[model samples]
Target: MVDRLRFFLNRIKERLWIKPLAMCLLSTASVFLAKMVDVTEIGQIVPLITLSSIETLLNIIASSMLVIATFAVGSMVSAYASASSTATPRALSLVIADDVSQNALSTFIGSFIFSIVALIALQNSYYDKAGRFVLFVLTLSMFAIVIITFVSWVDRIARLGRVNGTIDKVEMATAAALQRRRLTPTLHGVPPGTHVPGGRAVYGSLIGYVQRVDINALQKYADKTAIRITVAGLPGTFAAPGRVLAYVTADLGDFTDIDICQIEKAFLIGGERKFYEDPRFGLITLSEIGSRALSPAVNDPGTAIDIIGTLVRLFALWCAPIKDNENIRIAECDRVEVPEICLRDMFDDAFTGIARDGAAAVEVMARLQKAFESLATIEHPVMRDVAICHSRLALARAESVLKIHEDIEVVRRLAKFGNSV
Candidate 1:
């Protein structure tokens, strides 16, 4: 089973399917065909037993439309399920190092959001007939809920750095801790500025089109319209560059190679966010900057049995009875061992929108259906089980979505603000 799971995960990792979108178009044709197909199936043996031409046509049209609708919704659910539950192993290097992908996190979050919208829409559906409406949504919602649940697990697939920059920073700090390194030795322990040794420089007696104001040019300067600073970093620091080089505090200087100490006096006290947001933050990923980021090839069918191995690693980490003691073995490639607190955090977050009580369950579930549909179109067994667990336990029992809501403030915050902009 583990081998098969790994093999299956490998087969469709990055496939781009157009089938879901085609469903509506194909269904339209199918609906018309269903209408015509009904004619041959129903023989005009007697006048009373047989319907007239107009009635038969109407019946065919209705049946065909319903079938098309169901087909369209089913295709959508399958697409979402496939993407979320793909089980593709991430980039090999990253897996070995345990570096998580930020892209996957974003995609997971995005898929989550999309699933919510789809589910909401699916639940709100209005079919031509009441029974058809319930059937359409029941089928659609099940698939969609499964998708949302599967995508929820994408975090497990994601690399750590993608979710929390500080996680990697802390790991880097740990490495730094082992070595004898000087941190801001020159800054006298103050929060130090960064180096800009060879980058371009600007001078400023600055002036530019500013937001509409009643002030005159002199008044603008008097009001410090251009925030001026006498910086060793030089003139461009305070002024806009595109406009006639705003007043320069210093004579123009060209960038030149110099000793590290020479540029150390200068600081990018505030500009680093704009300057290095890309390379500093973006360049660190496993994938190259211009290309598609990390794609783990963990799911090869031939080596798929190893997925069970990975699952064992994951499960030992997941269901390990012990906490934080290194006696339990997880993975050979694993660097940092799993802590029980990690699973605590995940399950803590999982209960955010869960339902409790029959009436509330119906409503929250109705809402869940809507949300899951929009965010993703999931339909995996494990995912279905999670939703069903909630439905059976929390909703049926009238317990809070997060059973221990009061005990977990973090979960409460996440639930209340999950949709808040």
Candidate 2:
């Protein structure tokens, strides 16, 4: 239950309106709270603040903040559009969820709301002399906040829509997702045996991607029914009416519709994939950006090369050794069996598109060969084997696509370099 709620809240945070709405509410509350100063002893000792001075400050804030807020919105929309055009549309979410940009816009709208509310309260004579003094102090603080935010926002907005900036955001998100998966390889559940135990199958009601799997809910159901539940649809798995989400190793006669409904509810399906629990989605999104860059219309091999380097760093995190303490599994889900993410699938997600699209570009092919060579050097045998395998595949792609004999030779030499490593 807690896991599901946290997942829900994280998705909510991604919506652009959440921060601004919260800021507006707080701004409105602060105006009323300022009036409470009239009851305090400090209000009696504070110097008198004239109504004209307070009105003038509020007027300045009201007049300027709305304009600034409108400008901020326009700039952000342009940035979003630029990100979608230059990079993959999948990366637009990360660009929109950028903290600095969101906070800056929130500050502007909040300040505008504060000024408007304060102006109304003053017109109604809501504040006494002391209360007016407190309001004056708040107004000055608001000005400082707006100035600082605008200055910081100016710097961030400059790069927010650029290709490099979008790639960086996607890389960071992918890295974080990869790290989380590394820590909890089985998602805190016990790893499956040789094969999933077969029995009754449970299918999802919807046709879409599985965004999250509520393991705790499955565990509870398993424990109550004295059955073992084997998860079939992990996060990122596409769901349809006929697809089995999980297998219940119990008698079909004993299962009820309510029981099946409960199991299906544990898997949250959405129209699109998310980067949170699904690391492959991030990998695929990055590969798409690289592939798009290599498209005929873009013809930018440099971006593709940059993406190769970023993927290398992200994959390196997977090769990093996990401490014994960090490897502890959550024993609470003893009745649930979940499959670990496949290494081969991950490699395919990270490199297949880039390899296919960038085969003709010597710089891209060379960088990819070097990337494979780097991964081959890692201490893990499986990673080394996979790297060598991909190196061979990429070499084959280059041989078929490169028209020039010199370009083929260059790529072939680099591909062989991985074997020597």
Candidate 3:
């Protein structure tokens, strides 16, 4: 259930309306709360503010905020478009979920709603001396919030849609996903050993990407039924109709249709892949950015270099050892099996496209070599071997594309650290 909620929230987070809708509800509640506040006792202590003054302030806010909200929406749409064009379109989701822009827009809309609500209430004589004072205080607080949000939004808006910003966002997302996977390489379950488990294959009904798998729930079900369950698909895998998602082994009998339906619910299928638990998706998106920048029309080798550096940093994180203290092994059910991510796959995802596209660019090739060199130094033997293989592949691509001896020599020198050729 918790994992399902997380999946739901992640999907909702990408929408622009959630924050504004929440803020609107809060604003409406605030207006109602202000009316309930009793100021009769403190009427003598607090100075009585005139209704006209409060209404005038709210009028200004109400009128100006409409334009501000519209402008903010326009700016956000423009940013999304710019990010899609400049970076990979897959990264537009990250830009859309940007906290700064959403918060700023929510503040504008919330303020507008509050002002209009207060203005209407005042015209209806809903507020007395104390209520007017309460409204004034609320308005002041709203103004302060708007001011802070606007300042932060101003700083973020300038870079929100740019290539660098999108790269940074993707890197952060990738790092986070890698970290999560690194900790729980087996998704809170024991690694499945090689064993012949003869059981019925339960398949999903729809064709879509597997967004998330509720491992805990699967484990619980396994524990209850005393059945051995092996998951065939991970979060990033695509599910086809009648495709075997999992294999269930039971000594008594095969699982019923209702039981299969319950088991299938553990896998969350979506229209598109998600990056929250899928590090490969993140790596692929980063590579897409480098591929975009390396295109002839863009001819931006610098961005490709930047992406190489980002990939280097991400792999370094992936290379770090998982602490022994982390509790990834679940004791309840050892039957739930999950596939592990191969270093070779992630390495290929990170560097293959960029290496292919930027083969002719000396700067990109040099950066790619340096990135592998950095990865080679990490303690993990698999990381070293994977980096070494890519380094050689990158050098070979460069060797084929590069015409000048000096350029070939430079790449060859870097290749010495990876392969003999």
Q: Which candidate tops TM-score? A: 2
Supply candidate 2's per-residue lDDT for 270.
96
Q: What is the lDDT of residue 170 in candidate 2?
A: 89
Report the lDDT of model 1 for residue 347. Answer: 24
Give the TM-scores of the predictions, in the order they appear: 0.17, 0.96, 0.94
Candidate 1 local lDDT, 1-45, one digit each (tens): 232343234333323233223433443333233334233423233
Whole-model alpha-carbon lDDT for candidate 1 = 0.28
lDDT of 2 by residue, 120-227 (tens): 999999998778999999999999999999999999999998999999998888888888788777776788889746888999889999999988888888878877
Q: Any idea how many clashes model 3 has?
A: 0
Better of 2 and 3 by lDDT: 2
* Model 2: CA > 4 A from native: 1-6, 251-253, 256-258, 323-328
lDDT values of the candidates? 0.28, 0.90, 0.86
Candidate 3: tens digits of C-alpha lDDT, residues 58-176 = 88888888998999998889999999999988898889989999999999999999998888888898876777788899998988898788888989998899999999999998898
| TM-score preference between candidates 1 and 3, better one | 3
Clashing pairs in 2: none
Please state the error at residue 353 of candidate 1 in Å: 44
